[model samples]
Target: MSDVGRDIRLVGRDLPVGAAAESYRALVSELKAAADVLGAVITSHKVAVVRAADDLIDSLDPVAVECGEVNALRREGTFLRGFARDPMSVGRVVDEIWPRGEHVVCLGAGGSAIALGRHLLSRPEPPSLVFADRSAAAAAHLESVLASRTGVRSDGSGSVEAASAVVHVGPGPWDELVAGSPPGTLVVNATGLGKDRPGSPLSAEADFPRDAVLWELNYRGDLALLRQAERQGVERHDGWQLFCHGWAAALGPILDLPDEAATARRFAELAAPLRPRTGGQ
Candidate 1:
């Protein structure tokens, strides 16, 4: 493989966000001046890292600024740059699957919610968005954030509330959200219920749209949502592709690549060696 085309090593450390607040000084102190380290990929302190990397020649991903996940980091000349690319991954994956004329109902208004909302609005013929979260305020905040990004007021001429295209839904009515959406609507499971913990977002009696497309943002572990979608014969997808492109996009700029696709292609070729030798069953 060429120098730029080779797969860059991805090292990870899982630190709790709460602890990051208390230990940030010591943490960064330890991480500083580690020459072999391209950067540190910190999941828990996503927003904190982005803010810290803002000054000087270092770069931070705009998506990471919006949502708080899948950040790519690299240090250059004493500055650490952080980038979040999950939104791009969502765009690429959704484009290949549903493309146009698909209203999207994203379950959970967290980082993925922000990613989905922004991408849906940017499409040539943007799909309508509905953010459903256990917290009503989070859903509302997502709508407001997307409105600002889309260049409209919360209730402006083309804003979510004005046209009724995008709605922020609270808990206990998830089934209603699903039933109300158009058939073939894109339903995203951005919540950590199934992966980070046990259980599915939708209740046992919840029903999906007639031909909905379900995108569960978890590759493994308890996959109640994926199984539910499959049982209903829905077009379902997992997080593997999202994971690949997200990392590719996040690290693209750091690696001096022009675009996410190139990074992804190179990584795919390199990862081929790790699949078969990968054990566990």
Candidate 2:
């Protein structure tokens, strides 16, 4: 269990329904009997404790939010981590797309989007990031918060000259929002649609440059959109790498893991219970 970051194991019941409680309890009970077990992190990705069994698990252990339920679980001492509903891991991928940028357009005002936006602003000379959503009120709130911190206007409407990256929150249609864009634009998908499903962050209507990098944030397995990008002559990035990026980003506060090359290798070798077997066969 002490395989660097691999020491962190994600455990959960097979289904997103009721019976998982007893199953989870059994798993915990078994782990407690082990020698080097440190702590457990219950993931709240699909829903928050509505499953009768998950509620039971929540009653017994600490939980981690997948989409951004930090405020909801703040009193519970749950730490914040980004989980992209989209196939690509947006925060980590965006960091790769633009290590430093003038501006970033973030579609969707969910938890992961806000978390990444905040992380960006925390960087020394952070990029000007914008939060956009169908809910005008949601976007307005995020915009106000960012404007106060970074002093850049977050009107959610402007030119790429004013922004460098455009991240779509979910698999929702974002091409309409970015129809008018300059070339060499950096587009990112922050939604969870492509994680275990098929869909692009942007729509087929808009013309995303072939040279553009079409990154999906899901970081699970092979995504349908990856093939689409390949056919379109666009470069595609695997989603799992983003998870590695995220783990590295969160190493300091979450696990305090070292960042040396060997440390990374050791961390990758560790088995993570967080990953699930997709398409239940």
Which numbered prediction scores highest in TM-score against the true structure?
1
For each candidate, what TM-score against the reference?
A: 0.79, 0.55
Candidate 2 per-residue lDDT, tens place, 1-281, comes to 35455555644434342345555446444444545444333332323222222332233212223221221211113322322222122344566656664444454564456556655765655665544555554455445434434544344355222222233334356665544444444445555556544665556555655345555555564455555556666655554554554444333233545653344344445634565433211
Residue 25's lDDT in candidate 1: 49
Tell me the number of clashing residue pairs for each predicted model: 0, 14
The TM-score measured for candidate 1 stands at 0.79
Worst 10 residues of 1 by lDDT: 272-281
Which residue pairs in candidate 1 have backbone atoms (N, alpha carbon, C) closer than 3 angstroms, thus clashing? none
| Candidate 1 residue 79 C-alpha distance from true site, Å | 1.3
Q: Which portions of model 1 miss their true places by more than 4 Å? A: 1-8, 17-20, 23-29, 42-45, 48-70, 149-173, 266-281
Error of 2 at 28 (Å): 13
Q: Once superposed on the true structure, which residue ranges of model 2 sit more than 4 Å away at CA?
A: 5-10, 13-37, 42-93, 122-147, 152-172, 209-211, 248-256, 260-265, 269-281
lDDT of 1 by residue, 106-179 (tens): 88886667777777777655666777777775666566667665543353346443222465565554778887
Among the numbered candidates, top lDDT falls to 1
